[model samples]
Target: MASGKWKKRIRRAKGGHELEQAAALPYRFENGHLKIMLVTSRSTHRFTLPKGWPMKKRSLADAARIEALEEAGIEGKVSRSTIGHYLYWKRLKRVFIPVKVRVYPLHVQCENARWPEQKQRQRKWLSPDEAGLLVDEPQLMSFIASLDTDHRA
Candidate 1:
């Protein structure tokens, strides 16, 4: 469990400042080259990282790991420290709310044969450069392009 800001919840606020979420940046070193995994959005079928709201009784990193498993069917080691963060707009019924996401680095161990949301999402592995093209957020695109080398397992 986490305390302080990580534990706060806000339904609505100005500039979407009250909205915060956790995201998993799934990656692996493939033959010395970095590869990132992107999943299709259920409604739009657009590409994006696997993300969701924080869950009760879970660390933000653990919450992010669960999102990866549910949305992309991948399991792996998740870093307690965030690699970085980015902003994105989440579509609701009649409004698109901005969300600030803290990204946890996930070193993918394996993709499951079956998992939740498997029927609703499609997963693809691409180079950091390739992944950047499909990722809509400028900050996320830059984050992928850089792909910080100093990650701990």
Candidate 2:
């Protein structure tokens, strides 16, 4: 599967590193213009993509799709190939763990009114530039900027 290739592409640390996560960049077309979806983080409430720890039994892409379903209440075709990767610090108890996130693009085909995190987080559909401004992570912002061209291609 492409998972092996994805693993090979990751730059490993010489000694050790923080855990990795999977995320989905959900997008859809609105009046021929591409719009991307961003969801608020549960605690920090920052605008972010749907992401979570990797699921042991599912491929990374599948895990990404699951995250989107749970966090954004959306489902769609997820690309097995990763669009890109990013690093972010996740707060845990007393420490901030650096997390490497593998991102997959999901062409959202459905949005459920009620889903697992519907009450916990807010979801919004914004233009690529608008979405970029909403996100805090620099890597994520670049990814958002690239979404318009990537989605078309």
Candidate 3:
């Protein structure tokens, strides 16, 4: 998707709004129905996709795949192209920072019985609509809703 479509007002301090770099919308086929994985955030316990900052020496898609392994404990073929982008507020020590995340779709091939952050977060598999309802951000929810028919991934 075009980045212009997601452009929004970004509040900044001395530096600027932070970019999360990459995020993975992990999905799998369960009995012919598509289900997405949503993980609880470490601090707030709110539902969110597996995401993190960019890693050194890795492409955004690779970093997104790594985040899925670390945050959600699942890995598979990550789409080479981004599906969409969204803006969210990340709570900091005294303020909320705007974060722009480029999203990629992961066609989940397997889920590990044990992986990093296995105990820190609870993962749930739900239909796209159900997952959208659980997520807090309107843009993120819209992205999830778009996935139902989006074929780029």
**Highest-TM-score candidate:** 2
Local distance difference test scores for all models: 0.84, 0.87, 0.84
- lDDT string for model 1 (1-153, tens) is 244433233236333455878999999877777789999999889899998988889999999999999999999999899878898877654566678899888999998989999999999999887899998899988777766445312
- Superposed on all Cα atoms, the candidates' RMSDs to the truth, in angstroms, are 5.1, 6.4, 6.8
Q: Model 3: per-residue lDDT, tens digit, 25-135?
A: 998887777889999999999999999877789999999999999998898999989988998877655566678899999999989989899899999999998999999
lDDT of 2 by residue, 24-112 (tens): 99999988899999999998999999998778889999999999999999999999999899998776544455789999999999999
Count clashes in each candidate, considering only residues at least 3 apart in sequence or on different chains.
0, 0, 0
TM-score for candidate 3, please give it: 0.86
Total backbone clashes of candidate 1, pairs 3 or more residues apart or in separate chains: 0
Clashing pairs in 3: none
Cα RMSD (Å) between model 1 and the true structure? 5.1
Query: Where's the lowest-lDDT run of ten residues in candidate 3?
Result: 5-14
Candidate 3 lDDT score relative to the true structure? 0.84
